[model samples]
Target: MAGKGFGRWTVHGDGRGLAPGAVVAPDERLSWPATIGIGAQHVVAMFGATFLVPLLTGFPPATTLFFSAIGTVLFLIITAGRVPSYLGSSFALIAPITAATASDGMSSALGGVVAVGALLAIVGLVVHFAGARWIDIVMPPIVTGAIVALIGLNLAPTAWTNVQAAPFTALVTIAAIVLITVLFRGILGRLSILLGVLVGYATAWIRDEVDTSKIGEAAWFGLPEFTTPTFEPALLGLFLPVVLVLVAENVGHVKSVSAMTGQNLDDVTGRALFADGLSTVLAGAGGGSGTTTYAENIGVMAATRVYSTAAYLVAAVVAFALSMSPKFGEVIATIPTGVLGGAATVLYGMIGTLGVRIWVQNRVDFSDPVNLNTAAIAIVIGIANYTWVIGETRFEGIALGSAAAIIIYHVMRQIARARGTSQEAASPASAPAGTELNRGEPQH
Candidate 1:
């Protein structure tokens, strides 16, 4: 039913419990109580990273949350709930936003965001009509895997920075997550990230790492500060490259969810992109950070094995409510860096692993030097946080790595095929198990 995609979620089983090895599908939900708990878990999973983008870029955190929640709802509707994702403040926009704000002010930076969003929405429309086949031709399993893996690995330093702030607290959080997964059964075990953060937060509080002073001064209810965008053609260069990163992120998100849920979500890729673009446009029009599909929430879904979009809807509503109350947002913002570091320690690594899982599932033939080198170069570039600057425009790790993966894969493959050396020189018998060298046109 169309309603299933909108409001009416079919209860998974009796809506009480998930049987062993069974997942709650996108259109299905557990009981209201269980679904709400899962939904809140998704919010917790997203909160640290989502808010951090705005906090770092000097955007209002509550305002970012407000648009993030709205973006998520738009994504659900646009995709007809087939894709489970949360539109959080995208880290890829950070450099450009900072530069734009520094030179042209916050409103000018927002104008850059609106420009990117509009462009992305246009790309989404193209993909929706033309189909995602070009994506496969351009970004085969090897390239896709490289992009996905590098994205997570690229954030390793950010996690380390937080760990350095409070090593002991970070360690405790990590240990809590590890133990929770094995020590408990069912939902308790699945919610290790949420529970681990709580454990970490308690530890931080006891160790005097948390400050409650701001919470008391915050209002119980109020609107987040909003600002209108003003377009500057000069800033467009800084923001345009971001569309490439957002495209990679959105596509990787669809691929990741498809792999995890055993569902083919390629058909919804355009809708996903359009939804996020629309969300970002809304954010830029008001005062909020530009949005992208979040990998942190992907980590949560992997751990919980629940792909229900219903939970995402619940999470969006909860986030929207929290955005309306400064006190609530402040309380959440008080989550110590150490706790985030610890959770990120687990979540970030999981994201990298998902990319590898993509390779494994697709049987990517790394024996082909083209495939091997693509992953090799891109992953290193991303993990090392490579940067290239062109005047005011900057292409960071994710952008550089994503571009390198596509360029390297196609250029190398085309050259190799022209020379009739598509297969590696090594003996076929020496190829790794479950991998085969393709001598003909590559098939995704």
Candidate 2:
């Protein structure tokens, strides 16, 4: 943390002697050296999914990296570094961008992308003015947990395939991570995941799975190929529906962060929402796909329990630096499936389990037929990767689960209300909106 523009980052000398996943609040800080290490980890956490967007949508990968870095800094500025989040290319918009580019005019197609950003910004503004009550109504604990759990379940097959493909290395990687988390303490404990990854990467090299060919073929210095958008009204209408998808993804991300951090961040939620939207607009103006808060980083934060904004700043800086170096990306690309696969298996599983944590922490009324049925069915549906496609708008995966859970809960509430004298459903949840279930405990 430096300069007057961004708030000050106080480097704490007492960053040691804590357990793995030790809680570090947004306002707290680690030493500058440690912060850099944490930052690099965050970038690595987001790399797989962020870069995948460009490969699929034909947007420049480097541009996505560059904007993600810049957007992260911008997000920090807007939120005063109170929120620990990473802005990255959103998979939610992948289908829309692909469809838009089918006619071969990417610049024109990006015009629609810009509108999508604007819509997200508008949603943020609404949240800002309306208060986060809507978030509570839309995503109570049961619904949030189902959606979160579904994310891990949906990724189950991918994790299985990657691990199976390279069982020995994958097992080594997982063993390293597990041992560190269980055995280490203090700074060593906090950094277990990154250390485990390094160990795994070393194993990959020993197996000759690390490929340096791409790194050798790349240039040392260059700019990401950037493009300027061409505003086209027709396509703008076409891409607007993506705003709905974004809302679902972002709201869930913010809620998860709130749950993880044990901070009632409903006030800051609007700022975060707006920052993501603005990031999309800025990325699109330069020919990158729209951006959103990445769940990958959330998983990292969850596993590490270090949610300092300083770490995010470090991630942004490293990402920007990497964006300019194809060789650096190639080096990163050398990370084998075995390493990432094992790491993701644990990380994604942890992220998904947060939903159940929320459920138990909040003491959600499972006896209530509405709550029980909504969660039960919604989790199954989401894990199956179910989707609701209406016209150009499509909601799938976690979003579909979230939408269904919320609707079902409320609809059951309504039916009970209509009947006027019913104990058919048990009592509603006693917790208030945006409740933080367990106070002062670090989430694993």
Candidate 3:
């Protein structure tokens, strides 16, 4: 099992230059030096969003990095190194964590994380035994796309709030990201988010927006802090929704890799889910944030055309090394609200766009009223930030929107089919393929 993660990669080419249209496979690597360089690039790719989750949610950034590194390794091992992915802090869990922390304390939030992880793990075990067909049945392309889209859109207000804090800095950061993507190609283009963050950070400092006292006070090296999870049954509702998002993320990851590598990674889908759930469980126990397969690293793989698990293992090592430094974590923590706002504005929209990509890639027929209505209703509920509270438990936009999508899709589809009206007339809501509505596809 250890060998699966570390020793099985065959060298790709002369370990120097990648030929045009060439890709390095998960089980293959370039030379050690080249591989290490790519691994470092992976670290940079995951850095922005990985740290952002913890910073936004009040978790220890170092702890999140530590578990993220460990989680990536575990994912590789569980999938037998067949799938190329990097597990990082999941944004889906942020809302639940915040609510739980507010209601009961951080310990209760950790407990919620554990419960969600356990639930996801159980789902994985079921998928492993029964196969993943049920996932598709429950969440067709329409529902999946809507759920994905709404989660991103729901977070837009948060981005705006941060942007309002430092509007000028936010604009600089957003502009930097936009310019960087077009100005450069290869790894640099893929690293636009990290680069833009640096640009924004510099701009913030110049504008006296960042507070660096914490960085100076932090120690050079130490272990990340750990916390004990205290499960509160009442808070469980706040986190149950995240399980659905995580499942969507994991399945989409497997499918994306399958599409890119031309390999049938379906067999490892359950393992991927289980690995992520187990990683989250470990993270909650250690005071880190819940983990997910990161799309940022997927972008790096696409840009560099290197999918070697070896590089991911190396990336994990680098993250682990960095997490050992309290000072490094503090430096990340000191990034100003404006810089975060700028980055989030771009990043969150891209996430919403990803849902549309899923639809386009799958050729979802939105003309079917079932599909159109599902998305229309769910997206509104999510973007409008709908809220419903029951006693001490609360379900907000993401949770409600997800539920609405799933329920609406299934109910509407079943009725349409039963009534022999599945093929509805074309409507403006359905756009042709290759149009502005349906063009790009998600790298993840």
Candidate 4:
């Protein structure tokens, strides 16, 4: 029999041998050798997006790496190492970073981002004190499912954009991932994405698509560039609203992990928020792009079925180590756009499917107009990619959809209750003949 080994978690099984069908959950772990290797894969999974933000925003790559490492460590300590998330540069801040960098310089924009972390921490404090009851009241099964699904769908364009760059290579990569994921069992299946990317890189090399020139020229080791966040009151106007977007992203990310691992992380929501906020704040202060939980790593978890927080730490360690090597970063840059694109296609789609699976597993009642309307509206808003700007704040599609799903669902639920409609009642048109096949099972 096993008891709690670390903090609040009950360590299942002897830590020596992993039994068949014994899931390696966030709290549980494999052997150290296996863990470090898996952690490296997680780094591979998060690499494309983590590095892309700095590359695009003119932020120093070293800061991204260094802060990301420290951020992960901080998050692990804050969440009691229960959440298996990788903190990386958030693309959500790209717009604000770009605008601020143009006018007030990079340091000022970064100062504003540090302020964002403080705001998020306050929000986290509120969530922590309020408890899950009210939060769940607002973000019930249907609403959470829609929000999670929106995240996956929202990235569909990015996947397509990369694939368009090298169609054949991307196609080859996709096929490799699908074949490996479907055909192989055990660790091979777990590493399918890594193998797919590798195969795609080879294909790219054959086609002369990968640039080989940078590998030799890059330094073996160098300090990552860092910027000090200069206190700028004005920058707050630009990035404050992005907090809502970050919250939406984080909520969906946590829910997705819960759905995948059959673990209820509701209790850790406050800590998670606090961890991400502190990470962003730390990253900003250190002159790195604001860090957030990465979907790419989440997708890797879904695909690999490994949720070891230790493994995530390994990834963080690997990323931090590699940050010192410009050559390593350069090598990563050569991994053909097509390869990353193809992986994105499968990974992103899998996230969307996971959302659908959540709805199915929870047995969300589609016959209920509340459920139907939320799902319908959320999907459209997610795919539409619309943005609204007001007084320097911008609400993108996912942010708007996340808000809409919560607001519209609860608002309608209130109206229905006022009109004396029972919460259990289904629409006559959607559930004919007293059948409720569309309804999901009650969650444990």
Among these predictions, the greatest TM-score belongs to 1
- For model 2, the stretches where C-alpha displacement exceeds 4 angstroms are 1-6, 16-22, 232-238, 388-394, 420-444
* lDDT score at residue 131, model 4, on the 0-100 scale: 75
RMSD of 1: 4.4
* Candidate 1 Cα misplacement greater than 4 A, ranges: 1-4, 424-444
Q: Which pairs, if any, clash in model 3?
A: none
lDDT of 1 by residue, 1-444 (tens): 132675667888888766676788788888888888889878988898888889899999999999999999999989998889999999999999999999989999999999999999999998899998788678877888889899989989989999999999999999999999888877788778889999999999999999889999999999989999999998899998899999999999988887777666777888888999999999999999999999888888888888889899999999999999999888988999999999999988999998998887776788788989999999999999899999988899999999999999889988997899886442211112122222333333
Better of 3 and 4 by TM-score: 4
Alpha carbon lDDT at 389, candidate 1: 91
Q: Which parts of model 3 are misplaced by more than 4 Å?
A: 1-58, 91-108, 232-238, 256-263, 295-311, 424-444
- List model 2 lDDT by residue over 152-257, tens digit each: 6766666777788788888998899889877866766667678888999999899998878778889988899889888767666557866766776666676677
Instruction: Report the lDDT tens digits of candidate 4 across residue range 1-444.
Output: 121322344344654454444567777776677667668778877888888898888898777888888888888778777678998888778888888898989998899889888898888888888875566766777887888888888888989999999999999999999898878666667778888998999999999999979899999999888778897777788888788778877777777877776666777778888888999998888889888888878888887788888888788888888888898878887889999899999888887877786677666788888788989998789888778888666778888888888888878888988997746643221101101232443233
RMSD of each: 4.4, 3.8, 5.4, 4.7
Clashes of each: 0, 2, 0, 4
lDDT score, residue 321, model 2?
86
lDDT of 4 at 345: 95
Top of the candidates by lDDT: 1
Which candidate would rank higher by TM-score, 1 or 4? 1
Q: Measured by TM-score, how close is model 4 to the native structure?
A: 0.91
